[model samples]
Target: MGELARALTRHGIRVRVVAAHSPGLPVYGKIGDIEIVRPRYWWPERLEMLRREVGGLPVVWRKYPLARVQILSFFLMHAFVTARYAQSCDVVHAQWTLSAGAACLGRWVHRCPVLVTVYGSDILQVPRHPIGAWLTWLVLSCCDRITAVSHALQKRVVQLGVSPERVLVVPIGVDVTKFLPADDVHRENLILFVGSLIERKGVRYLLEAMPQILSVFPEYRLVIAGDGPEIISLKQRAVELGISRQVDFVGFQSQDNVRVLMQRARVVVLPSLEEGMGAVLVEAMACGTPVVASRVDGIQDVVTEEVGVLVSPANPMELAEGIRTVLFDPIRWREYSYNARLRAVKYYNWDIIVPRFIQIYQSLVG
Candidate 1:
């Protein structure tokens, strides 16, 4: 969204972004001529209400009923706010599937063109739920244009009945300046993983592979960054495997912190079963850190042999072996690290990506 917003702004278009209230507000605020409207929520009050309702329900009933209500409320509230804010815009550009649903409703009421971008899970995972699937179809059919982050996602959108001509592939761009390599290589005994602690992210696989990794390289330490619902379980698993001492769970780090962490580490790892474009992989590459990722759709597109090592998803043995290969061979590591930076500058940087988005927006609104 930041990339597209900046791209459009550069082309003499005033861009307004509506996002959830959280981190990264200041970054958006600094973008000249762009208006950012973040929806605010009274977290304490909301949490109290949620707690009251949740306490009354039986465990079985609490799962689906409460989940459905919360989701519905979020969609309705976002739709209401987005419609009001998007009234003056010529086109509504939505970033995700839920946002697309909100945009679809907003466009319907205001009679504006709606463009929805699908970035993996929004098309693949969301559509599996009955309500989400219905909303997915509605947004796909109503949108003026459907942009996907990858060709794989474009195909998924088309399979969901969106027109082939309306769908465009526009991968997210990396900020070359913020993510470039450190001035000097300070070799450290660190292996870093930066992403959500979800099962699909294959965090469990990383933890499972720890024993093997430690057996061969006892001095090597694994740094797990980012937090999610599965953190507790992951921690428990690490303890059960007797590798908790070797794992460092560094909660969530800022972009600057992540870049620094990537620069200091020997290699970065992402073992996701599925991904949109794996933006962090490029970020690691941009920082001159060799990556070991799954050979899944989005990861495959990003982590070529030239830049990083690709292994089968959810296979602990393969993941461990791949990490070993990169860590043991300094010659191979140096070559991959060099190529990774080159790939980031050539293909994945914001300069290249932003222009492509500008072309899309110009073609749509001109």
Candidate 2:
């Protein structure tokens, strides 16, 4: 959403981000031309723990059961604020289903088109439950247009009874200039994994594959960036596998650091059990780094035989083999790197994606 806001502002579109408040962050601020307003959902501010995790409501409901009460306040406050802001906006563009639910309320105040973007679990996992299915259907049905991050998601949305004509696949774009290849920097014998340390990310399987990856390329090391609930267990698993020396858990990284890591690493890997579209894979590709990711929904839409290897998810052996294919062979790695950069520039760059968004907004407003 940050990228989208900046891109829209660059094109002279006024963007105001209204979201649930988080601790330590100001209730209102601005990043360049983008206005950010984080509405407070819960009272006694410290009790506001709903938006703390990477997975949002689902994770909060499953892990911190007591924190689920905040959902009521979150929904009420989010909808109220969204409706307040809707009066000034031309279009209400919500990023996820939950956000769309709130944005839909804005129609009561200002009769404008609401665009719902389904990224992942909101359309995939949430709809599996009876109550969630009803809510997801209600939210999606109420929206004027829907955008999905991948073709896989578009098919799923159509399956859920949305019209095919209303759905379009517009992936989250990456800044090619910020994450481009550093030809002057020497590539190291490092395998990079950048994402939350969550179970769905399959980081443990990456750890499980490291020993095998080390057996062949002893000098190679694995760098795990990002932090989450799975950190302690993942570290323990790495220690148990006796590959602790070869794996570096560099907690969380800023965007600049991630770009540098992608540029320097020989192969970037994301062995996710499922993905919305694997923005990390596109970022790696933008850095001219070949990827070795899982062959799962959304991920397959990005990775192909030319730019990267896609192995079965959750299988350490297959992950190891995929990494070895990129690490051990120089010619194959170079070919993958070249194609990866070309594909990223052609398809995933922000330069190419922002215009599509402008068209969508124009169509609705016109």
| Top lDDT prediction, candidate number | 2
Candidate 1 Cα outliers beyond 4 Å, as residue runs = 2-13, 21-33, 40-45, 48-67
Tens digits of per-residue lDDT, candidate 1, 264-304, equal 98889999998878988988999999999998876767888
TM-score of 1: 0.88
lDDT of model 2 at position 339: 97
lDDT of 2 by residue, 172-281 (tens): 88989788887835799899999988889999999999989899999999999998889999999999999988899998899889999999999999999988899999
Off by over 4 Å in 2: none
Q: How far is candidate 1 from the true structure (C-alpha RMSD, Å)?
A: 4.5
**Which candidate wins on TM-score?**
2
